[model samples]
Target: MIGDSNRKMQQIPPLKSIQAFEQVARFGNVAKAAEQLNLTPSAVSHQIANLEALIGRALFVREARGMSLTPAGEQYQREISGILQSLALATERAGSAVGFDCLRLHAAPSFGLLWLLPRLDHFRSCHPEIQINLSCSYETLHFGRHQIDVDIRHGYPDWPSLEVRTIRHERATVLASPSLLERIPVSQPSDLLGQNLILSEAALVQWPQWFAQQGVALPQAPFALGFDRSYMSLEAARHGFGFALESSLLSQDYVKRGDLVPVFPAELSTPVSAHHLVFPRGHAEMSRVRHFLEWVQGQLGHVFNY
Candidate 1:
């Protein structure tokens, strides 16, 4: 009698068929569900049919326009949605524990260069069980389609449907080689007029913007040099090329090592700009994403507030 009961339980619909029904219910169309599942429409329809046969009832009402869930299908979906979510979470946790999970992180190029890459060694050392893959890009990446677990971007809070955490509030200041400072002393913003002004695309506030913020109009266009990255401008400044306005957080290491000296005592606080970590709305709870987020927050605790 127990064996018969076990055999009957084994006759339940496959998980894939249930998944197909769920996706179809979500999109209300086989084609759209197929696209998400990476299967053909016919396959999605076939799966739903198989599922319906197992339940001894039609799950979806076939229509000329598309498909709609039957009342039974809607009820089933309501019940199974939470089950699938829990199963997925459990599977992810298991995969991460077994070292089979790979966390993908995307970051702005400048942040990746000056901030994340420098500190990733400690993260890797502590969490040797988890693997990390990092990609740097200037373009905005969406969390869902891009499969990005975390994205570190330099911007204000504007992205929608993503969890945004401010990693650092940026303040820009003029920095230069000590030797260059010896040649040209800056007492006020106006004194920067004749000096070489290095501008970087990656800067939260550039030379022009910083000067304007300081309430000093450049009497003349200073001899300007432009670089595509903030690090490049800092490198040029280290070689005594010119003065560069840089974020204090990015220049902390250089300042400590005496590679760059502040040309001015004044700092231009950027009220509307900051470094933020973004994640898909629901992904933050996943073990892999949660681990990385906690590690990063801990590493930058001094620099960032929750």
Candidate 2:
């Protein structure tokens, strides 16, 4: 059994190409990397090319003064850097083989609690060493004071210095429990007006907005119940109290799990985009933040403009 296991073990790889790739990523210049490694610029470039070929992905965006890492290259560089660091410290810095990275992520309460919290384990499964410090609230993040690595914000993207990417390309629709639907049917858009409509003070798109899309006029009366957060509204709706107008992206699990259902056909739904990934220019360069963002990009089904 021991002999078989040893025979199945993969052969040791050539570390020269990996080193060359890391050096180029570090300096963003073949000449500078070659200078440090005591090799010609051509040799450094050749080694990186071999590494890229072996991995089957371009690692750099070649430019005039230097080369910049591509998105894939950035992630690869981060992983390779950690491994190389571990190898270097193996003999000298015992028990400190792998590097630990921490990501401080802040997000809207509903998204954090209902959506991200459930899926986070998948990220942990892939990157067990990456530590995540997550905070959820409706208030805007104070980047400097909070020391947030990145944030997920809902509503319009209007920060002055921060960059924004729309994380959810989704629809705004009326959702209700089967029991609630049985009590008050919603065959048309105006039918929701008669039912107990849930109100969320923190919602990016409200009942009025959703009704307006269907050319239905909403009344000035109060809702059956109101809440300060979207999660509460969704939970109330899921319990059959009333219908809720929410993002298809945020309410996906509820609908899938049979806790809630879309009241209208998809044709009646309105295209609404609210959730966004927000970060400073320099923060995107950090390995931990970049890694999280990349993983987030993979979580959503539709991730472009709505």
Candidate 3:
């Protein structure tokens, strides 16, 4: 009975020691494993030493080249790796079975309202099983704090520490209410000079940029009403308050309904503001992430022409 008890005790490793050694062995560097495991290099080294002592064997040979696993260590490493992989797979399967495959989506408020919200039903139809939690705000999101699975942003596509995919391009155009258009006949871009201009604080330079693109000198400080958000500016324009520079994509529904009219027959177009889909760099291998990205790419169709 004592012999059996001793054998059982020998078969089981000190779990903390074994875990540290496995990480170090798999990475082939104590420092690298320590970083990944959120432990110090010294701590990892100490754990490895304790493991070697418990097993009554030296697992690694420290050399000028680097640490190398001994033959016995290599054998033990293979077994440990198999065990870890099995545990990971089992955990993943259990999580999935419990409907824990959730995706945290972050998006800018105006873009979410005008563009993404309209098309999100399609994504829902495609990924009915994947729960998506969307956090919409006007400010830039901190991906680490929000634990965001994906971020949809409208900008230059140069976000740090993220994998970026250009989902769509954007163009800007002047939109005015049909009532305002009826009152003042605007046949060309220059005709906008006499109209009350509505401006979005977020896109203050949009009109100036559009005028520059058309090679038309903007009237110095035209009478304008300014709002903090694009959606509010668009709302003001819809109510016949004034003309506003709006995304061709977002203005299409109103334009088609004759609620809004474009200032010029030839719409002022710009190099598409790259609407990007971003995610954490290291999560590219996750199956759910891969699937969602593929779906997003497939759904990207040019919904506007100006």
TM-score leader: 1
> Lowest lDDT 10-mer window, candidate 2?
84-93
lDDT of 3 by residue, 73-177 (tens): 876764554344334544655867675576677887777787677777887788787777788875665443346667777666664335677655556778889
For residue 2, give model 1's deviation from the true position in Å: 23
Q: Candidate 1, which segments miss by more than 4 Å at Cα? A: 1-97, 266-272, 302-306
* Better model by TM-score: candidate 1 vs candidate 2: 1
The candidate, 2 or 3, that scores higher on lDDT is 2
Relative to the true structure, how large is the alpha-carbon lDDT of every model? 0.76, 0.78, 0.71
Off by over 4 Å in 2: 1-98, 303-306
Predicted structure 3: lDDT: 0.71
Supply the global lDDT for candidate 2: 0.78
lDDT of 2 by residue, 18-65 (tens): 778767876788988898778999998888888787677899999998
Candidate 1 accuracy as lDDT:
0.76
| Each model's backbone clash number | 0, 0, 0
